[model samples]
Target: MDAMEQVGARKVTFIDVLRALPKLAPDGLRMARGAVGLVTLKPTNKESIGHIFQRAAAKHPERPFLRFEDTEMSYGQANALVNQYASVYAAHGVGPGKTIAVMAGNRPETLLAALAGVKLGAAVGMINTNQRGDVLDHSVRLLDATVLVAGRDYREALNEVDTPTVLDLDTLADGATSDADPEVCATLPASTTAFYIFTSGTTGLPKASAMSHFRWLKSMSGIGGLGVRLRADDTLYCCLPLYHNNALTVSLSSVLSAGATLAIGRSFSASRFWDDVVRTRSTAFCYIGELCRYLLNQPPRPIEREHQVRVVVGNGLRPEIWAEFTERFGIDRIAEFYGASECNLAFINALNIDRTAGTCPLPFAVVEYDADTGKPLRHGDRLRKVKAGAVGLLLTKVTNRAPFDGYTDADASERKLVRGAFKADDCWFDTGDLVRMQGFKHVAFVDRLGDTFRWKGENVATTEVEGAIAEHPDVEQAVVYGVSVPGTDGKAGMAAVKLRDGTRFDGTVMGAHLANRLPSYAVPLFVRVINEVEQTSTFKSRKVDLRDEGYAAGVTDPMFVFTGGKYVTWYPDYPAEVAGGKIRA
Candidate 1:
């Protein structure tokens, strides 16, 4: 019916577009405004993020741009601050191809300083606030930063690292002047590096992913303008860390592109999330799957459904909880998406589809892969596409339109590239994710390729198992991974679990619950009751250490073994029994 809907129908089908017609007016208008905003905000030929910010600020000087807790900053005020910080950074030779390592929490200055670096055409290395010791040091060193800017709270952590020119954020803010925008902002190109966001580093040390201004602009236009469809009056609540691409690129870009307000939270708090959402008068919010689960687990609050939030955007909203989360919270639209920090491809739920990671313009493939070897399975020198609904390795073809900028570490970037994926001389960026193709270019996220392990000759998706385990009322959290059993051909399924407050783990109840939900071999063979599961800054479970610990008898954590009928306490002889083939999965 509408022009936008007519265009969209060509891609998603006319019938689905007809189904989406009623809701298209608002979304189409918002998207139209966003498209206009994108063209006006970003320079066509050569422009930096600072230029875009300046343009937006010039247009909506009085509009509220950033809200941190009780404090709010207008577009003009935020731009002034960024200008001052940019001046300081420029004085320190932090411009054009240089790197500035920034270590801070979700404070206003964190974003201000990062934007300042952007203004000066410098790449801002956003360090995870939760990282410490070796990982922290590695992140800083990997950036090869000319200057390390740190917040007061991270002083102790900075003291441990050997970085060049560590500057206090307070001093920089106090000394800088808000007179004018940096001259370098005009000279910078869209292809210039803007920021370096670290990958999850679940396997080893995190690699710094290079984000160019071109990619940021694309994210703003594609995801913000088209996918999120936020209006200038809308306010998006963001609680995730700024270091993550979800918060930095998705949430912030969406808000900025629409000239909307971004209400920032110090960090995710299950108890105070709704209260804060209400406080900010937020019309929308961003989420990961775990954040939604945490909110669902908390006692239903009066303010939960009382907020103005109509739209929820971001990735990792699982299919199992999709209906319940949307219905219970009274959320109107869920823009579930699939992307990675380093990868170029993205799939967004543009049509408000349930339980799907939407569709993308980019060319991608779901190819058969060997779970154990972590390699794509080939048929006569050609990679094979998996049947629809079957789990497979997801790869995005590398082309001029969707180029993989990759990581700062050349070796790490090289490792992710799959040459001759479909044809000779062809290259694809391996997403390292397992997803089930649902036809119509949509996909259902299955599990991280590394997280899925083989058990009883069957591939077990940890996310699927975790989803099942989480269904149990008493289970607060579950981290599933494969653990080696001596003399066993394949790894055994192990789960490190945390129970709800004041709830004790009942082996019989849990066993029965898991048995009802999962297949015989898919059920976790061992369960370790832990106080808390270790998580990365982005709330992704850290399974490498847990996998390394294995099922050692000397381990102090309370361990249990599923004896087919019920979970039983583990003893010293359990390993021997398993190795001797006495114990069976």
Candidate 2:
């Protein structure tokens, strides 16, 4: 029997176990090596990130540390630059407990400024550069930063915000000296707040998630050293913006911990991606699900498999495209993981399992949940665990070993905690995600709980529908949400789609596409032709407002309804037909 059959049976045959052996071998070796390092060269609680960089520079002064386009900075050179910036920040009284808001695109100086703040025992607020007007203003003010460091490209966006001290990145290093490492680096404790990474804020305004130095160090050792398993000679390529934790903590921390080189890209470009990999000679690269999908959609290039990339790591890789991506790109390994900026739970694909989010060492549970209310179901005041292979809400137990540092907003943080989840006085952090728990602590991510809606007595995952719609060649982007039908018992699926430039929508083609790709009940009943889909800085589609807009006939955007076995322009009579029982949802 094949893998799918085995999964259905909830049984791992000898063949299945054998298939995982090859992937497990390297991880075992890497974990063994990491164990030795953990015992022999563990970092002290008092040593800060600056001290870690200092030690790496001392050991590999001449090795390349960072590469951006044509520019390369050696460990020694980068350390010198960091020292200069640290000195400047120190002069401005940016130290312990102070917050420094940093807004910039992917640039070498951006990393330098953030490191300087960490060096001085200050919390660095990594602001998304794409934000503008009121959103940008609110972000800066929300952090209550003592200083604002704006990149040259984003000066205009900062004009509206009222900050105490605003400094330009272009001239931050002009007059500063390459002074010794800041004194605070040696004194800061592991519990000190290192930075604040904002949540993607798909449902509402973003909240600042506090990242402690202790967590950063753990990420470096856990994810970087053991998960990616990079060597000193390896160069990890990253194109995601630094404002997000995937790039800032996962990619950067791994490279620093392994003393490996980091190749930085100005931004992600599907056309230029392979060329960048070839240019940097990257041995591994970081990715998101969307980035992988974009690359897969592009026409095959001769240079696609020419690079030295052996392992690729990141989250959001869909199971449908997982095998195709690795096979097409000749990737030897993929380290797909599941984690959130604020949540304490993390699952790493250390064993190289296909389609599974791997296992977590920390405690977690998949409990029965209600689709309508988007909350875990309770049985006599006790949370119920879902059966194996059943989709349910994922919760992580909050304890000292796996603590939730939470967000800067106390109330927002409290809202995420579910007290007495399983027992009295016990607390669990709700991940707000649904997953199917596989055997051996592995999980297959299903969808966000809020995005799953009931339709036709069946639960429909918008992400699944959106993924199906995105597979169409003509569809550029798809935002799937549920709209309440007048006569229907539950919401009906509606998709807001942006087609490829200059391409026109053909309802017959789209209807056929959906029919072929998704289940009959899961297919969207309506489609809205939109110019563009609004997205968070992290590229997550905003769906709350889209759901509110629904299938309003007065809206200017052209709308279509699937009827008579094909898609047709939505007319004024469509709602009346449903109300009169002439049409069925």
Candidate 3:
């Protein structure tokens, strides 16, 4: 925790640098090899995901490639099924430039279906399973997929949506028996679009972000081979929805890179998490911050600390809980990385740093920003870069080497561009995230630019406030957001919290606890004790719904308002402090 604050200012030790230098050389060579392979890839037969899997199967035919609770598939077996499925898919006009949208949950078949399409040079759309009706229709139509592979459970979900040729996943290969490699693999190039991973629709409709096989390979080189550093025997446990990049690219790609095993869970279950990890004999696991929080909140079981996981990887592990999560779980390294489903660049904690999002070679900037308005602070014609250690808006440069390939729609939250950022005619892609520019090419995530609010002339970060609230022993989880008051100048901070079992919400004690941790201006003005927090499939709290229903009559949850130094019952139209906004102050 102390090192987090000193990240950008700390002096590097010679011993540490010497140790890191040797490890970096292998990563550099690995990434360079991937770059060279893409350019030199044979047009007909090499470097695609399918080709990589085939090579692994040929080398390690008997090694387990995928492990589910009831199913264990060896590299040879999985590749054979993938080929069989590919044979079936190719018959339906699935080939180069065609798209195969898959609507399913995390299962062995779900991953097999995606690989089957990619083997035939078809872009696989990883559609969100939670989506239905209009959103589902838009997602399906967005790709105009030549075919759709849907699992049995999700067939009813797609019944109402307009989709392309739908194929029942289990019944797809009814008569197909060939397990040999598909002929289409010979014609596929490395640059072909491999997948269309949709963004988590926590805010709104998800966007289909296109990713080429080359980029996916780059992630394998950077995060898999270098960061997680998986071996042939390592099993990476990934419970996140397969549609997300963390699962599909980071965890799975890393496994493929090492010719290792992949352990899949149908969905996240806090109670069953450790059990799954132990059962799969996982050496590593992917995570989001919310997943960590859920685990921390649960009463410890005997197996919680006893596990084979030496290193854990993924993004959104907040600094506040980093030490606690590691200390409790006895993890050796945490590859807390920063990258989006659509972003071209990624920062991996290859050095196994404690509090930073790690380092990258690509060019990026943390420019000064107005958190409240979500605007970059510009000086004359260019946005001003933040001094090292200062929090600011994060922007990554677009280049031929690392291109910004994600699609941006008109209805997006905002135009994700910063024109003339530092020099004339140069444009940077706004990452929509606030980050601290740690020295030596390192960056630490602060909060989302949109997850901030101006109150009493001070910008309050919701993540920071949520961290403070969640730190309390009695609180299981907390989500902070800004809400409107009748006479307030700006939005006021409000929190939706879930308390631990058998714990009572004592507003006075909670208020005092927060006051000690956060400044008066940053402390949440209103607090609601909820039975449960509504979360997306990825464990991201749905803040929009909570913010929109702030202190409203429809909210049956117990609500409290900060008044003076204590909190009081908050009723509908509570306007006692609405005039002065003393609660926010």
The residue ranges of model 2 lying beyond 4 angstroms of the native Cα positions read: 1-29, 33-44, 451-585
Backbone steric clashes in candidate 1, count = 0
Most accurate candidate by lDDT: 1
TM-score of 2: 0.77
TM-scores of all predicted structures: 0.77, 0.77, 0.75
Off by over 4 Å in 1: 1-17, 32-44, 451-585
Q: Relative to the unseen true structure, what is the C-alpha lDDT of residue 476 in candidate 2, on a scale of 0 to 100?
A: 97
Question: Which is the winner by TM-score between candidate 1 and candidate 3?
Answer: 1
- Return the clash pairs for model 2, or none: none
Q: Give model 3's TM-score versus the native structure.
A: 0.75
Off by over 4 Å in 3: 1-46, 200-203, 408-414, 451-585
**Candidate-wise lDDT, in order:** 0.80, 0.79, 0.78
| Residue pairs in clash, model 1 | none
Mind giving the per-residue lDDT tens digits that candidate 1 earns over 482-569? 8866544346789999999999889999988887656566688899999988888887787778888877756798899987677999
lDDT of 3: 0.78
